[model samples]
Target chain A: MNRYSLNQATTKYWSLEDVVAASAKADLSWIGLWREPVQEYGVERSTKLVTDAGLRVSSLCRSGFFTSTDAAERQAKIEDNRRAIDEAAALGTDVLILVSGGLPSGSRDLDGARAMVRDGIAELAPYAQEAGVRLAIEPLHPMFCSDRCVVSSLGGALDLAEQFPVEQVGVVVDAYHLWWDADVYRQIERAGARICSYQVSDWVVPLPADTLLGRGMMGDGSIELRRLREACDAAGYDGPVEVEIFNQDLWNAPGQEVFDLALARYGEHVA
Target chain B: MNRYSLNQATTKYWSLEDVVAASAKADLSWIGLWREPVQEYGVERSTKLVTDAGLRVSSLCRSGFFTSTDAAERQAKIEDNRRAIDEAAALGTDVLILVSGGLPSGSRDLDGARAMVRDGIAELAPYAQEAGVRLAIEPLHPMFCSDRCVVSSLGGALDLAEQFPVEQVGVVVDAYHLWWDADVYRQIERAGARICSYQVSDWVVPLPADTLLGRGMMGDGSIELRRLREACDAAGYDGPVEVEIFNQDLWNAPGQEVFDLALARYGEHVA
Candidate 1:
């Protein structure tokens, strides 16, 4: 059966308890969580809450910001990722998502930064494999290429995955980052079975200022969700489709309202 | 010698004649005029003003919006591009820039749209080639991928160029669009003499709303102009670097002030 998971970032205004309660009320089967909330509630307590509520942990929000030119800084990021893997293991999460950070400060050496990303992922893959937490590389929107992720295309992420063992490194295909790509369908086909997670959101035209928080909710913007789902289905990916929106307007609304809206939209547009 | 050309979009408030006079007063070697102004002032009169001011027309502002799923609509776009090429030739400009339009309405077929773009360009290239004008593909910011140009990377543009005769298909390396790309340096090296125009501008962090119009002036944002210049220089591109900006605030200012600021910034940061 197709399932929907709420990425906690969608309703960041809500506390962990609020999210769990709302997820249970919304009858959602799965939930994707971020590290900050788990840390805030104490991982043990948060784990207990999800377990008590009978919600499956789909995946943890993130584990990588791996493009540091400095060796020490790069090593520290990898160490931090190892801890995130441990956290994912504790929560019995299936995947630990990774974001390739942008170019190091004051440097226009994009290839060098990409090399650093490859090295960083290679260093962390072994530990993630041992911990049973699949490392899923999330290619952010190309707008974030300068400060967030050097890996901006699914093909680019797949190219990076070639460096790792098959089961260890995979990709998180978020519609927001790739919906507009000319080669998306072909790349999704190429990413078959290697796609660790599927994330959905809409692309709002004339992007707002403070772009980080301006993401649109499902069906509220221009993405053809049905087509994207068809592509995912054809690609042999049966993972929980996670809803990850970062809209300021939605975030400011009541947590229950946001969850209800996500649930209704997911059923109408994606189910 | 390093020479500067002001892309009139930076000071959109100025009339074409006023912009030419301002360019002359600034002692700049060239000026880039837009289609609307040329139509408004009459192409012949604008040409004479540029000639009288001893200013060379660096390149025309734009020409292509090729991505249409509709056959007739797409053909109409090609016809429009033919006229744009004639205008560029009339102005004695070396390059007629092309921007591949975004996804067609109600279509999630990115590949289909790209095919339309390629076919459109192929149909239009002969006219440009015959007119002795180069059609430069300007890969816009990836943020514009949905509604603006689908071609968002230098590599992607170069790939498109490889499908056609080299002289008929070239690329405009706009720093604002290519600066964030991870493979920009290598792609620039690959572009080499195939680069028809080099556009310089900065990427301001925390961009304002109406992102299309919020482009920062040179040196006011984070882009490393000198590094890109060096890369282009190393790649054997000795073309005049054109300053193209689309800031609403700057556009609201007087033309003389805008040209002076562009010249000063180009000398201090770009030259």
Candidate 2:
């Protein structure tokens, strides 16, 4: 339970105050937060809510769609990322997740998009480090590579992260996004503490119409979650194991119920 | 035009005779065939139909759903694969594509699934080699990893392929399945002549209600088709550039028209 965390996305309808209260009441040591909700609730107020409730934020959901080809659009995204860094700092979390957006609209330049990711990280690394936050590059599944995030493998994320200081940047080993890779175990080992977070979600097939909300709760699908958690532990990551599902069904359930179910499943399948 | 191969699935409703006649009319040098349809039409009859029209079978669509954990089921798949190799030999195509089946139903043993693929390939290689057929393992997109093919990247397919004699086993580099991979070009380079066929398809987004049929015509999506085709050529794969797509919309279109469109797109995006 000490290392169990509920990423607010699993209970998407819940407010920041509600998530913090639920996590603290459930005796969970950590809660992962999204920037929008935190900002909407007022970062300072949200920060105080979690801190007062004796809960720590595991990571800030994200901010990094740097694949834009247009110079002005790219600069705007980077600017927003700067604000994300400040928000992460306010939330008292060292980790801020980054989802590198897909190929620019109508563009076939995948390599150029990946280069933008690398350049974006280089531009933001010092800023993140100065703010005492580590930007965690989250490699989404290859299915989402065309539109959501270009970094589709942990090894690919590490390729970019390795170019920065470990404290400044790292990779998030989210089992749902990465469990399919044959080289994932080796990449997780290589990630070490460069593994900023270990998020758990199962890959249930017949993905919903909105594939974004298709993530299943732990233990409900095909992932070998405990094995992944074990791999992370072996790689010297003893931090909180965040349960971050995005299923619409989970979102509709009561936040506390979702949190409780996630914790129980985490115990059964990932602890 | 000499290298253009019309993969039959792009015109799913077309008969083997129609595909052959269309390819002949289009002046395409090759036509890729599916095992079931060819078998239904009689392999010898289909072979003669294609050869009579001056269209060579670029490759046989597939075999090898050997991920079953059950012994009897596994053995059955291998025997079926043996027959597929014989059929490929009869049709006079050296490449018999393999889609390593997904994880066994309700089984979370992905590594075990991959092991089954490797072992199954090992078991069938001798027969394929005897038939003068090179088993080309096609790594489907990672989206299909759980229920379609365990092998999800060109590198992963090559890992299994390199374990066997290159002439007996090889990998298929399909643009739709592999374009998002950062290491695809490097893997293509490593694949060298082990690349048995260069399959092309475009990756369009907001995948249809049935994601399997979401592939777009080459010029309609984001994959860098010409770049990938060139990668294969650079890797010494000067084989037919097989234009294989699984779009439901394309399937419903007139076969000859689809063939013409595929040829045009092949020239514009893949040649």
Candidate 3:
């Protein structure tokens, strides 16, 4: 119970205040937040809301699009990430999830885009380290490789993370993104202490036309959620298990209903 | 031109006779065949038609749904695969592509499902070897991992292929399925002589309602088709480069138009 956290995205319609209050009411010790909601609520006010609710921020949703081909756009993104780092620090969360951007528009240079990601991280790691925030790379599923994140596997994410100090950069193990991988268990073991966050969501198929909103709730789909949670535990990660589903159906449901259902499913399938 | 083959699926609306005739008319030396159409045209007649057209069958499209949970069904699938091997031999193509089935219904044991695939192949490999047919594992993109092929990467395919004799088992390198993999180049190099088929299709996104039909024509999407073809060549794969797109738009277009365009694109981007 102490380790379970509700990522606000799971209940996308819920206000920051409402989610924080609901988490506090449910006696959850942690909550995961997104950059937009936190900024909308005013970062300091958002921090106070969580703090008053006695909830710690497990992680920030994301900050990374370092695959731009344009120099100015790339530099602007880097600066934006620095602000994200400061936000994570201000919220008192050590982990800021980084979704390495996809291929540059009209370019087929995957290797070059990946190199730019590495360079982006190298530049930001120092700043993140000083701010006491870890830039946790979240390897999205390969389905999103061309348009979303080029870092499409846990091993690939670890390869990028291992290039820097362990404290400065880490990886997130999101079951929704990685449950299909044959090498997932081995990579989880390899992640060790570098796994800063472990997010849970089932992967339902016949994915809607918008593949981004296709994630299922825990236990509702085919993923071995408990097995993955055990693997993360074996990897020396004792952090919050954040429930971060992004389903249109779940988002359309009442926020409280979705929140309560996520808690129940997590307890049954992921605890 | 001698190395270019047109997989019949790219022209799904075309009768097998039409595709083969078009391939022959275009001076193509090879044609890739699917089971249902060949079974429809009569395997003996289909073989003679290709032979009469002076076209050699590059490979047989499929046969391996070895992941059924039912004992009777599993046995039935193994027997069907034997027929498929005999069919491949009858068609005079040494390569029989295998799409390992998805997880059992209501099951989340991915490792167990993969093991079933291995066991199925093991039971059938000897028969395939006797028939002079090499079982080619086609690792689908991870998006299809749940409802389609459980074998989801070239590395995973190689891991299974290496367990058998090189002559008995090989892997298919389909650009649309494998281009997103970070370790693809290394895996291709490692595949070496274990490569039975190299299928080409670009991966266009905003994937349609039916994701299966989302493959784009060569040079129409994000894949580095020429780079991948070069890598396969470097790895000693001098076999037919089969153009195997599955886009709904292409299927609706005139077969001759699509066939000519595939040939032109192969020369421009994949050859």
* RMSD each, Å: 3.2, 1.0, 0.7
Clashing pairs in 2: none
lDDT-best of 1 and 3? 3
Give the top-scoring candidate (TM-score).
3
Q: How do the predictions measure up, each by TM-score?
A: 0.87, 0.99, 0.99
Candidate 1 regions exceeding 4 Å error are A21-28, A66-79, A104-112, A189-194, A224-236, A254-257, B25-28, B67-79, B105-107, B189-194, B230-236, B252-257, B267-271
A1-271, model 2: which lDDT tens digit per residue? Answer: 7998888878889887787888887888898999878888899989888999999999999999999879999999999999999999988899999999998987778778999999998999999999999999999998898898989999899999999989999999999999989889999999998999999999998888898988998888889999999999999999988989888888888877887888888889999
lDDT for residue A247 in candidate 2, whole number 0-100:
88
**Per-residue lDDT of model 1, residues B1-271, tens digit only:** 2467888888888878778877787677788888888988988888888988998998997888988777899889888898899889999987988889987876655667777888888888887889988899998887887787888788888878879887898999999987865468889999987888889988766667887875788877657788898899899888789999988788888777887888889888898
In model 3, which runs have C-alpha deviations exceeding 4 angstroms? none
Position A79, candidate 1: lDDT = 87
DockQ ranking, high to low: 3, 2, 1
Clashing pairs in 3: none
Write one digit per residue (lDDT tens) for candidate 1, span A18-92.
Answer: 898888876778899999989889888888999889898899988799877688898899889988999998888
Which 10-residue span in candidate 2 chain A carries the lowest summed lDDT?
A16-25
Candidate 2 ranges with C-alpha deviation above 4 Å: none
- Winning model by DockQ: 3
